[model samples]
Target chain A: MTTSPNSYADKAAEVAARATPERLVVRVRALSDRAIAWLFIAPTIVLLLAINIFPLFWAIYLSFTNFRANRPNAEVKHVGLDNYTRVLNDPDIWVSMQTTAHFVFWTILLQTLIGFALAYLIDRKFRGHAFWTTLILIPMMLSPAVVGNFWRFLYEPQIGLFAYAVSFLTGIPTSEIQMLGSVNLAPWAIIIVDTWMWTPYVMLICLAGLRSIPDYIYEAAEVDRASNWRQFWSITVPMALPFIMLAVLFRGIENFKMFDMVNLLTGGGPGSTTEVASITLKRDAFEAWATGRSSAFAIVLFVAVFGLANIYVKALNRVKQR
Target chain B: MADVTLKGMTKSFGKGGAKRAVDGIDLHIADGEFVVLLGPTGAGKTTTLRLIAGIETPDAGTVSIGGRPMAGLAPASRDVAFVFQQYSLYPHLTVYENLAFPLRSPARRMDAATIDARVREVAKMVRIDHKLESRSTRLSGGEMQRVAIGRALVRRPSIYLMDEPLSSLDAKLRGELRLELKRIQKDLGATLLYVTHDQIEAMTMADRIGILAEGRLVQIGTPREIYADPANLHVAARLGQPHINLLPAGLLPGVEMPPGTKTIGARTEHIAIAREEGGNARIDWIEHLGDQNHLHIKLGEQKLVTLADPDMAVAPGDPISLSLKNPLYFGRDGQRLV
Candidate 1:
């Protein structure tokens, strides 16, 4: 074959002969562009309706009735807003909501500040910056369950590196640093772990914002006689604010529904001190079998998150407009 | 106001400083003078401006502003205003804030009322007062450029350095802004150094023009002198609109060349054309440009374009006798022969 003089020509002719331009009866209808687009998206819409929309409406319907998953054959009574009222008045549920709020607030605040600082330092483009960035991103790359379990050992009083370091810093005994056991320190412990794991995600977004700013703008600022401090406050902060806010929004939503990490770490605490709303929801739906009340609680949480996110997105848009 | 002086200024980049972005060049910009550095891309014009503005440090020379050596001085301390080629206005700031930025600096410590008044004044000067409240990012290219210029103008800096500030605009906007800039500079009587590749901008605006080529200042003089008495072929080719015609020596009659004249630089003003039956040149084509006609001529395998009147009695293939009148002459080294 290698010695054949017209091998390429023969192959070309053979392939050309095989490629018969055949005409067959076409069955596809001439759909308008709008129809074609809808056709292409129909399956995704149907799947979303079946799995997401149907479940959502079903949860809403179930919230209105006193239905118990354990007693499936029992007659479900229509409870007119009774579950909502109960959820609103329940002190334990209130405490869980407060805990969720605290976690969201502290984690977002700490993550934003630390993440923005880290992004600023990385934007300096120093030597070993690539290695440092990769190292910083390791926490975000790990599974939340792994991160939670990993931090659980670190929060241990006797052998934990974190407890030992804190004890050494403050001259306190390592045995007294009951991070997971103490009511006061358990929330802080979870916050620390979450901030450690998710701060890199925020930093990545902020780094994008910082890098989007052209070098000429800084040069122009310098020529305008702005000091480095002034430039950071005026140019750097304002330009990167939208990205920072986006990171906050993401972490705020994710941490609100946080179950796996907290469940893995302390299982809602040494006495429900770290009992976020999701853990309460899980206990109500599965352990207590109060499906109606839990559904109401889930709907309330959904509405609160959706409303807050909508307001936050509007504010983010305002910042971006600036 | 300050006079800028550069002595043996040199800058280079890359390892071991192999690529010289700016070579050794000496220049002096008198106080209240407008100097335009005209060059093609990568000719070190912007680098020269950056070096003077202290955005870049010289590698082997000194830059002194107001007779004070600017060594180790930061750009913010140099008292120079630079308008970048792209409008580098703060996207988060409005037109008014952009204008007020320099005044709000802690170093300036301008009062709020005074800053507001100055911002408005500069905005009005640049004809952007109507859009003062609009975000800088929301502006069109022309409006943004106006805001950028206004931002530079708000401060009473010692020198203004602009790097192709009008190049980003369309032709009409560039023309309007060019006139406005000249007027504003005249009103302020401030020292300004402008760099552009557009010949018309340099020729029309500069009190003195400096031709830069390959990181060297090839020639520096009044625009008229630079256009009429270029030091070399490069400087001669830098200023003309239709471009100066470089022809082999003795291509045309009626001009006395100095000894060793290897090239003749014939612009529209230097060339004399007359219609004839058996002429030495033939009109290849006449490009109609509304106001004036560009006559492309062919003479013995050589082609040259010269500007002619729109109603000139000539068409393609018309034979014409061409002569040179005190045209510029250059030697084999491309250096002008007086």
Candidate 2:
């Protein structure tokens, strides 16, 4: 499957084919199953191109020119990489980039560790494992906006159970608990919520990986004089690592572009401490009406996440192929 | 080396309709003996082997290795090695790492150099030293199986528990590995309990073969005893190559059975075929094996096969005479009576 065939085509053949006459389709009915299958899927292909792909190239085109959608009567002017230079050079943009990286790093770290541990515990098949696993997954099933606002209320420091519990456990007064008010705690607060919601996503994947291992492998290990702890470390972890990495990659890309959760939590407030790259882009495109600069920012973020994820996926494949 | 003793061992599955996967059966394998448990699939051969390795706890009775009770002992603490029927090599690890896994255990705590030497040594013993660096996923099925065998042999446990280790290989490779495994077992002088449904593997490799049926030990003897003097109708039909033809005792003309006898079991090789124009049976077909011919003789309501010389001129529709040199009789309960 890794070896792709030699015929690499264009982005969307739908527009190309659809642009042709209807007679062209009737003439192509004699094609093989693979070709006919593509014809049947052409509608999806066109929809994805018009939505997912067309806008991508349009963003790239807009990134290279000064085009603001708000001022439709004004003439469009070519800017030639100036937007890229400005966005890259701006200090506030750099701060948002750092914020995005910080959020991505901490959320993935906390999610992977907690999720794998949860999966390991659930794999034991205790009396009530299925019920508990479903209960743990409730947070992930809820809408992000709902969860974000609900947690915001829980961090209110006045009558919030979270604030009161932390105060009771840490011996700090609930009045001093201003999770969204402080810059340091704002990032930590969003990270805590994201981990709580998304760790179950990771745990589901890791659980599948854990269950796919044959029971005989453990039997053979035990017969070879391998202790349970040794089997867990050597056999269980390595075999499940590719799945773990896949979970990390998904969580990483999602957290990098995270918006609604952070927006609802602090609204990039008190300052821009929690203003991730997507939030900054949203402000520039909608608030400040700087379409070209925001497009350039979006392009840069895309390339960064795409390139890193590509590298991580290649490493995952190698681990799988091992 | 160690001897194994299974005393009244019993195991079962399901709750209400519990099937006794391994019924209560006592067996003793002496020190340095290569004993094969032969049976049809799902006949508790594997379950019995697992019970001995401590992989599955017996519902009743006990398993003792070298005269020590293995009641609550973990499989790791039982001084045993298991070679699974499927390729159980760790796919994430290199062949060397897989072979070195047992030595690297905390209980062993072998140093790096010692582990490396032992792994290489085992790899050489299994004839896989050249492919030591290859990861298991990249290895061919045969190579992966060799790595699995090497992994079990690396620790050099006192007893080896193998569940159809060679059943996954092709016929030629299976024969070669059978010889190699026999040599290795002899060289190590380890007590080995092997489980296999293939009669050829059991016949060729076992010092003594134990035939099991319906989770019970039907018979335990040398290959000749089990083959020539089968315990019942099932064992006779199980271990024979061309199959022992079981016919009603009344079908044979001059064959008179005792009061309890109801069936006659005759091996194909024992019956000789002679072409006679007025014989009792007519030849239905002739299977021309290179060295011998198996003639299908139909007599009245029964059909049986008899061996003939390859040079014998025989064809379908030729009247044939059957000479049952010696056929064993079985009672209504399917137990052999002769």
Candidate 3:
């Protein structure tokens, strides 16, 4: 038999043609991974836009309009910078802002400090550590509304257990003291309730951080001639700082937007003295039907939280990079 | 520097003390001597090192450094530095900061300028001076190990304890670092106690090697003495590459002795193999190593390996003669008979 040169070339070209399509298909399959990844991420992006971005832009728009909820048919006339100026100059708004700052600063401070201390104590793995941790976490797990209502009863003047116990312990009269009614005591009451509710959350985060450290580190530090206090400062604190900062960021944001506990416990109480921004915004929009002004207030609160949270996220990223 | 001594040292774990992790180990290292504790896993080498480092208090023994009792003195007070196998450099700190940590430690109490100078000096000694500004996470395995050593060395502690510091590196790096470690220990004249299961490391780097087995000190000697005259069959087996071959041998009634072949112990390289030609038996297999070939020859009922030249051609199932040259005879209980 004789083989033609042209026929062999034709066969080789036919083989190449056959392999090219399959190779192209493989190439297309490999390229589709990026598309699949984008497809998986798209839903989260859409949800974030719907929940956070859309409401933010809408609030900003409403803040510049005179669209009061009581007058629905009234024209949404543009009032450039007027509501912002009013909110900035308003004495009541400033008071609520001060109250918010006070709550956020004190609550975060106390929560972080107490939570870290408790975490360090529990990390020692003594007897009944798990039991004690679970007990501490009960306050964090309780519904804020229920806790507020329960605390209100406990703070009752004569009949409540807390008041009676305090009076019994200190030998002071419990008949006239009103925890949620007095302006001086109401902020402290809110701060106390907030710290009680969130300290356990911080403790849990710090505990995870502490437990993630290997025992060899302490052994090495011991071998390095590091004292107990030195190890705690250099090794333990630096290692747990990221988790502690995370707790602070979470508690700070939550306290800044704190409404449920304040609403349930004091209802922004006695003569606007305990009215936080959230309570004031609620009164403006729902009680007085001033949606435009409330939207402006809401926008301001959103900016404050967003800016602070962004800074905190940057700090967290820095820690993780380290 | 302190001469560390452990007398009747025993440590046990578990609630009822039923489990003995380290059982009755007695060891002493002279000041500025580099000693290596060699053992397999679960052999209590690390426990022994930790005991000497004061990380763990012995239940039965008293540990002393420089003739002072170390019963209640904390690890820091004992003036010992430990380098862990994991290289426990602070991940958040730079190489310089990690090296400076031990120097600035309150227990050490060096001033700021002194700490900086010592850190830089140790960093240079470890050949990681350029990496001083670099974060530890960015460092390679060898670099990290060097930094760990630098951290331990910066304080000039009385005793240096290293727990498998080179175990994580590759074979070539381990060999290179072993030499470096020996040179550094010799140059600094620091009392070093190193722990590793790698016999080669113990053999090459240790001034005096201590062999441990099952939480017990099996043997301790210089590398030459340990290799030449092992106290037991286990030490004989553990000290060699392919391990010393154990074969039952009976003394022939009036065999003439060969002069200058009276070394105690079976050296595999001394055994010879040739075609049987009406002699011992046959070759079972041939394992061709790169430089030399090992001929597994069956003599009577026992098989013994004989080193052959790489150029020598030998195949399996071939008839072969075996001759044991200067074989150390052991009795039924695995003890060498004179």
The top-ranked prediction according to lDDT is 1
DockQ of 1: 0.67
Superposition error at B297 for model 2 (Å): 1.6
Best-fitting candidate, measured by DockQ?
2
Q: Model 1, range A230-262, lDDT digits (tens) per residue? A: 999999999989999999999999999999999
Candidate 3 C-alpha lDDT tens digits along B1-338: 87988889999888988778788988889999999888888889999988887788889998888999899887878888898999798888899988887777665556888888888888888899998999999999999999998888887777899999999998888888888888888899999999998988988888898888888888899988877777777677777766566754442223334333222345676466676567667878888899987777777776666677888766788876666666555555665555
Instruction: Give the CA lDDT, 0 to 100, for residue A129 in model 2.
Output: 100
Ranking by DockQ: 2, 1, 3
Q: Which pairs clash (backbone N, Cα, C closer than 3 Å) in model 1?
A: none
RMSD of 1: 7.6
DockQ of each: 0.67, 0.71, 0.61
Model 3's DockQ score:
0.61
Query: For model 1, what is the error of residue B239's alpha carbon versus the real structure, in angstroms, after optimal superposition?
Result: 1.6
Q: Write down the worst ten-residue block by lDDT for model 1 chain B.
A: B248-257
TM-score of 3: 0.88
lDDT of each: 0.92, 0.88, 0.84
Q: Superposing every Cα of model 2 onto the true structure, what RMSD results? A: 5.8
